[model samples]
Target chain A: MRRRLDMQLDELNELLTHMGELCQVAINKATKALKNGDVSQAKKVQKADMKIDQIEKDIESLCMKMLLEQQPVARDLRQVSAALKMITDMERIGDQTSDIAEIVISENITESMELVELTQMAEAAGKMVKDSVRAYVNQDLSLTRKVIEADDEVDRMFVENKKELVEYIAKDKGKHGERAMDLIMVAKYLERIGDHATNIAEWVEYSITGIRIEGN
Target chain B: MRRRLDMQLDELNELLTHMGELCQVAINKATKALKNGDVSQAKKVQKADMKIDQIEKDIESLCMKMLLEQQPVARDLRQVSAALKMITDMERIGDQTSDIAEIVISENITESMELVELTQMAEAAGKMVKDSVRAYVNQDLSLTRKVIEADDEVDRMFVENKKELVEYIAKDKGKHGERAMDLIMVAKYLERIGDHATNIAEWVEYSITGIRIEGN
Candidate 1:
């Protein structure tokens, strides 16, 4: 039974790690599509949304089944729950990708807006997602803490970009307002993705230490 | 065992309803405090953040326990998963309320100056939350759909308010640019609460009908 539990956890952990990779790929593809004004690619992201949704549901059902049959306790229980919760963030990240794609498809974010800062935010957030999952799989507390701290930088970028975007849109008043709002929301969405990644990191900390993070 | 499952579900659902009520109240308190410049009230909302977090942890543990023991199938599984999912949104709504309260406490939203529209958005969002929760507890799909549709209005208000606030703050430039950005974030946060309410309503629909309503 112990060996089987370990085997089961390894499989579930692999699936979760793969899901995180899929989310990262989706975020990158969608952001690239946004930067390049590729409506077709944007549509592809939207079309692919169902895959992420289905994967989350599949993972959820599998987790429940494991609990019923395996009766995992302590660290095992934490792992399953973390996977369960991680998928929610993964799905929302997928949705944000879709939102970014939708904005591109609408042809509104077409302004040759130098999005260097926004890209940085996306990179930080995506890295956080990746690191948090790896941290969970390896039970690396330091890596998880790193992800949490990176999220603060991502949020700071989001607020700074939003402030600049608001001023840029205000100068033009409605001409750039719509697209600008979309960009801001996209940044906001990514910041939220960071927030969720922090959540995953916190769960990792809790799973290891049995001490919940403060101010989650 | 069947009776026990039913009773556990009833308790879970009741707890869900109460959490939803707390969400509505918290959002209302935060937004009113935003408009009225009531820093003390905002501080009170900030303090409630921990309560929401505690409730979320409680609900999460309960759901896990239920899933572990009952091995619920079909409708039962849906209810448990929906409750788990709804609490994530509820926790986020709580966070947004706290975010709003903190922004208000900082006096930034007031410095941006066009407050009436945001107040209206808050009122509409607050109402949507009430209806969303009612639909969840009562299993009223009609009401659930109504809340979903109302999100469009809330979203529209978000756009209009952003535009107006931008224009208003543009007049002063340096006077209000930074604070205006925070105000926009606060407005976006309120809009997100409405989005979460719609998400809860969708989960309610799924809980009742076992049909996933992702889009349309």
Candidate 2:
């Protein structure tokens, strides 16, 4: 029974890692589409979200099965339940990535927009997602802490991006207000993705130590 | 065993209903703050969020206890798990309500901004939250469907609000662009609150029918 539970836990870790990788790909695709004004890549990101959603369902079913079959106790139960919680956050990351792609496609955002802070925010958020999943799979407490701390950076970038976009609109005399608003929305989405990553890290900590942080 | 489980489930229902009421109050306070430019009310919303978060923790502990002590299976297990999922969305509703209030406080938005569509969106989203919780507590499928359908109206209102805000900025020659952008963010937050409510309704449906909806 112990070995079987370990096997199932390993499988759960793999599926979660795969889900995290897909989110990273979607974020990367969306960011690239925004950079190059590539509508096709944006379309691909939206299309790939279906796979992410499907994987979430798969993970859910597995968690349910583990709960009903293994009746895992203590740390093992925490690991399974935590997977259930983590997938929700991972799924939202996929949704937000698709949302960014949709904005890029619909807004027809050109590569000409000065998106320095936005790009940094995307990269930072994407890394957090990756690191959070790594922490979960490796059960690395330090890496989980790092992911949580990194959210402050993404948030700072979001605020800085908002300020810069507002200044850009002010200078442009509102000629580009709609476009700047779209960019701001995109930044907001990235910030949310960072938040979901932080949530995933917190869940990872809970699974490892059986201690849920307050106000998460 | 069955009677004990029933008693525990009733307790869970009471806790959830209480949490839902707190979220409604937060939403009402935020909306009032926006409409009246009441920074103090906005601050109240922020302070009240701690209570919402605490209630979510309470619900989580109860669910874990039910799962462990009762060891519920089949439909009973589904109900317990659904409660687990619903509280996450409920907690998010509280967070989004607080976010709207924060925007109101920081942006110092006045009631004279021609915010017809935003006001409409807030009312509609709040109703969806209310109806979704009612549906869950009553196990009413039709009401769950109603909440799901209401999301379309909120989505429509969001689009209309965005278009109107953009036009308003254009008319003001970029003078009110900052304020318009802030309103747009507020609308987006309300729209997300509607989405979370829809998710809760879906979980309620799952708890009732054991048929989890796809692509929630």
Candidate 3:
């Protein structure tokens, strides 16, 4: 029974890794849609969200099975529960990327500088999400810490983008104000994606180290 | 040992209720300060925040003890984890409220109708929070639904206030513009409080029913 339980843990770990990969793919495609102005690519992202949602449901069902059939105790329960919570944040990050795709569908990006910056932000957040899940799988406390530290940069960029966009609207006086607002919101969405990734990283830390890191 | 375990659970329940009361107090005091332009009261809310932080830490420690000593599985684990997650959002609401209090201190709100509307918005949010926590404590799913429904009203009020504030700024630029911005921030803060309370109520439902409520 113990060996079977370990096998189940291994399977769950692999599923988590697969979920991380799918999330990365969604983020990369969303950013590609923004860069190439590819409406189809953006639409592809929207359609692919159903798969991400399905994976979340699968993970939840796995967690439920582990709880009911395996009856994991101590750190194992924490691990499964943390996986359940971490997937929630991952799915949210995917949703935020879709929001960015919708923004791409709305406004014309005559210039590439803003789109480039936003893509870099999204890429940074995507990398954080990947590293956090990897760390959770490996139980590497130090890697989780790095992911947590990365959130500060995300927040700073978000604030800077907002201030600049607001200033642009103030100066232009309704000229491209809507577009600028959309840009600002896209940045805001990326920043929140970073936050959810940080939440994932913190969950990793807690499942291993039993510490809750928030607001600091 | 069973008696001790039950006692610990009771203590935890009491502590959670205490935290809920503190959140309500913070919301009330912060709104009152913003409405009355009471610097002293604002300062008091700021000062009391440290105490809230201490309570959060204390609760976390209790949760850690319960998890380690009692080896709680499934439902009990979910309860403690949800409380931990809820505390993070509750503390954020408090910080945002403090931000509003500071804005009132820094910027005068002498004659802005938007400020008045924001205060009412905060009151609506506070009522939702109070009701939701009550529902969670009682396991009253119907009351929880009511709390969730009230969130739409708070969100509508926020939008109405934001639209009117924008009009106020556009019509009379630089006249009460700063105060209008402050009022807008306060409204955003209260809306966020409603969001967090909704999350807590949703968790309560899941704890009872094993069902997930998306974005509740």
Candidate 4:
């Protein structure tokens, strides 16, 4: 029974890693679509969101079954519960990526209008997501802390981008103000993705240390 | 054992209801801050968020204790797990409300710039949140569905407000364009609050009926 539980836990970890990879891929595709003016690529990102949702459901049920059957306790139990919480953040990452794709398609966001800070922000946020998942699967507290700290940089980037966008709109309202607003929304979404990554990392900290970071 | 489980479940429900009320109050305070340009009111909203976060910690530990002690299965298990999921959405509602308050404080939003649809949107989102909590506590599938459907109206309000803000920026690029953009952000946050409320209602459905909503 112990071995069985261990195997199931391994499966849970694997599934979460897969979900993380999917989100990273979605973020990449959405960003590339924005860079290349590829509407079809954006559509693919939206379509891929359903798969991410499906994985979330799968992970949720798997966690439930482990609780009902294995009835894990202590550290084992923490791992399962953490997975339950982590999946929600992971799902949100997918949803935000889809939102970005929707904006790309609707606004006809082209390569010319892409803000340099926005792309860098996406890269930072994506890396955070990847590292958060890695920290969870590896139980690496250091990696988790790194991911949490990286959130500040993404937030800084967002503020800087917002400032630039505001100035751009102020200067060229008739030309690209609407598009700048859309980019602001996109930047906001990416910022949110970073937040979700931080949440996931925090959950990993909870699972490992049994202490949630205070004053969140 | 079953009686004890029932008692603990009741406590969980009551705690969640209390959390919901806090979020409702936060929304009210944030919206008032924006309308009144009372930075202190916005500060209150930010300060109150810590209390909400503390309550989330309480609920989380209680759920963990129940899982470890009661070892609930079947519907009782579902109730416990669903509460876990519901609290995340509840916590997000609080966060989004805080975000609105932050915008109000930083942007110095005032009654003069308040869009008609934005106020109405806040009201709709708050109602959905209140009703979603009621649905969860009452196990009322009909109310859950109602709250879920109400989200569409809130979303429509967001889109309408966004369009108006875009036009407002285009019309007055040098004057209040930045404020208009800030209002758009506020509108988006309200829309997200509505989304979180819908998620809570869906979790209610899952707890009551054992069938998760599809294509969310």
Candidate 5:
């Protein structure tokens, strides 16, 4: 029975890794679509989000089953409960990526140098998502802390991006204000993605140390 | 053992209700701060969020203990799991309300007629939080649906508020543009509060019917 529970735990890790990869793809494609002004690419990101949502439900039921059947305790219980918490943040990352895609397609924003910083912000957030999940799969405590610290950079970028966008709107007045607003919204979504990644890392830390980190 | 489990469930319900009340206070104070441009009031919202966070941690531990010790199955399992999911959203509502208050205090937005619609939006979101928690506490299926449906109105208000803020910014060019941007951020936060409330309502529905409502 112990060996069976261990095997199921391994399976859970694999499933979570797969979900994390999907989130990376969603954020990557959404930001790429934003950079290239490729409507089809944005549409693809939206479609992929549905799959992420389905996977979340599958993982949730599996966790519930493990709790019921294996009756995990202590560290094992933390692992299962943390996975349950981590997936919600992962799912939100997917949803926010889809939201960015929707903005890209609806705004029909053409490629511009203006989006360079926003793209960089998206890349930073996506890397955090990847590293945070890897931290959990490997139980790398240092990597989790790295993911947490990286959130500050994404947040700083958001403030800078907003300032730049506001200036653009100020310069163009009514002419390009809506487009500037759209880009600001995109930046905000990326920042939120970063925040969710930080949340996942914090949960990973809790699983490992049995200590919950405040203010993610 | 069954009676003990029932008693524990009732305790969980009471804890959740208290947490929900804290969320309501957070939202109410944040919006009131926005309406009055009272920076101190906004600061109070930030401080109150810490209490909400502490309560969420307490509630989470209770849920985990109930799950492990009681080893509840079927309907009881669903109730415990649903509580777990509901608290995350509730915690987010608290965080978003704090975010709104941060903007209000930092932007130093003075009282203006411009805030009327945004205040209304905040009120609508707060009501949803109250009703969703009430629905969960009472297990009222109809109230759950009502909370779900009210999200549409909050959403519509967000769109209208955004349009109005954009117009305000466009007309003023750079002078009031930052303030306008801050108001828009406040509006976005309120919309997210509405979404989180909808999520709680969906979990309430799931606890009652075992049917998950998709796309809140």
Candidate 6:
């Protein structure tokens, strides 16, 4: 029975890693679509979000089953519960990426507007997502901290991007206010994705140390 | 043992009600701060958010304890799991309310701009929160549907509010663009609160019928 439980835990880890990869793909595709003004790619991201949602439901059911069958305790219990928590954040990352794609597509934000800062923000947030999942899969505390610290850079980029967008709107004398707002919303979504990544890292820390970090 | 589990479930319900009340207070205080442009109220909302966060952690720990101690199955297990899912959304509602309050305080939005649509949106969102909690506590499927249906009105108000803000910015020709953006963001937060409420209602429905309603 112990070996079976161990095997189930390993399966859970593998599933979470798979879900994390899908999230990375979703975010990357959404941001790339925005950069290239690829409407089809944006649509593809939206479609992929359904798969992420389905995977979350699958993972949740699996966790419930494990708890029911094994009645896990101590560190095992924490690991299962933490996975339950982590998947919610991962699902939100997928949703936020889809939201970004929706904004990009609806606004018809073609290659006209400069997206240097927003792209950097996306890359930073995407990296955090990838690293946070890696930290969990490997139980790497240092990588978890790195993911947490990366949130600061994502936030700084958001602030800087907001300022630049505001200046652009002012220079256009409100003519491009709508476009500027869309860009700001995109940045905000990216920042939120970074936050969800940080949340996943914090959960990973809790699973490892049995100590919850406050205000990550 | 069954009786003890039932008693613990009762306690969980009471705790959830208390947390829901705190969420209501946070949203009300944040919206009130926006309406009156009262920085102190905004600060108060921010402080109250910490209390909400603390309560969520407490509730989560209690849920874990119940799961570990009782090993509940079937309906009882569903109730506990639903509570676990509901608290995350509730906590997010608090965080988003605090985010709105932060914008209200930092922007120093004085009592100059007309805020009729936003006021309506806040009231609608607040109702959804209250009704969702009531549905969960009472297991009222009809009330859950009511809460879910009300999200449409909140969403419509967001669109209208966005249009009005854009027009207001255009009239000022970017002079008050920053302020306009803040108002739009406030509306967006309210809309998100409504979404979270809808999520709670959906979870309530799941607890009752085991049928997940999509796009509520």
TM-score of 6: 0.72
Once fitted onto the true fold, the runs of candidate 3 whose alpha carbons sit more than 4 angstroms away are A32-40, A105-113, A214-216, B1-216
Question: Which residue runs does candidate 6 get wrong by more than 4 Å?
Answer: A36-40, A65-77, A105-112, A173-175, B1-24, B35-95, B102-116, B128-156, B163-180, B194-216
lDDT of 2 by residue, B3-77 (tens): 999999899999999998898889888888887778988999998888999999999999999998999998889
The numbered model that scores best in lDDT is 5
Q: Could you tell which candidate, 1 or 3, scores higher by DockQ?
A: 1
Q: Candidate 4 docking category?
A: acceptable
Estimate, for each residue in B1-216, the C-alpha lDDT of model 1 and write its tens digit. Answer: 457889888888788888888888898898778777788999889778778888898889999999999899998899899889889888888988997887777564443244788888988998888888788778899999899999999989987877776676667757766666666778888888898899989998999999988843
Tens-digit lDDT track for model 3 on B1-216?
Answer: 466666876787777777777778888899888878888899888866767778888988998898889887777767777677767666666666776676677666565243677777878888877776676567688988887888889888877876665555555545644454556667766877888888877877776677777863
Residue B105 displacement in candidate 2 (angstroms): 7.3
Error of 4 at B76 (Å): 2.9
Superposed by TM-score, candidate 3 places the C-alpha of residue A164 at a distance from the truth, in angstroms, of 1.2
lDDT of 5 by residue, A1-216 (tens): 557789999999999999999999999999888877788999999989999999999999999999999899999999999999999999989989987887778675554445789889988999999999999999999999999999999999988887777777767656667677777778878988998999999999999999998844
DockQ of each: 0.35, 0.20, 0.08, 0.25, 0.28, 0.21
TM-score on 0 to 1 scale for chain A of candidate 1: 0.92
**Each candidate: what lDDT?**
0.82, 0.86, 0.75, 0.87, 0.87, 0.86
- Model 1, range A78-170, lDDT digits (tens) per residue? 888878877887887887788678768866544455689888888888899899889989999999989989987997897788777867876
Please write out the lDDT profile of model 4 over residues A1-216, one tens digit for every residue: 458999998999999999999999999899888777678999999989989999999999999999999898988899999899999888988988998887778765444555578889989999999999999999999999899999999989988887787777667666766677777888888988998999999999989988887523
Ranking of models by lDDT: 5, 4, 2, 6, 1, 3
**Tens digit of lDDT per residue, candidate 3, span A104-213?**
78657666544656667778888898998899889999988898889888877765665554455455535644455456556766777787788888888888877777
List the pairs of residues colliding in candidate 1: none
Interface RMSD of each: 2.3, 3.4, 4.6, 2.7, 2.4, 3.2
Winning candidate number (DockQ) = 1
TM-score, one value per model: 0.76, 0.69, 0.56, 0.70, 0.72, 0.72
Model 4 chain B: lowest-lDDT 10 consecutive positions: B106-115
Residues A1-216 of candidate 6 have per-residue lDDT tens digits of 457889999999999999999999999999888888778899999989989999999999999999999999988998999999999999989888887887767765544555888888888999999999999989899999999989989988987887776676656634666777777778878988998999999999999999999853
**Clashing pairs for predicted structure model 3, backbone only:** none
Task: Give fnat of each prediction, in order.
Answer: 0.37, 0.16, 0.00, 0.21, 0.24, 0.11
Report the Cα lDDT for candidate 5.
0.87
Better of 3 and 6 by lDDT: 6
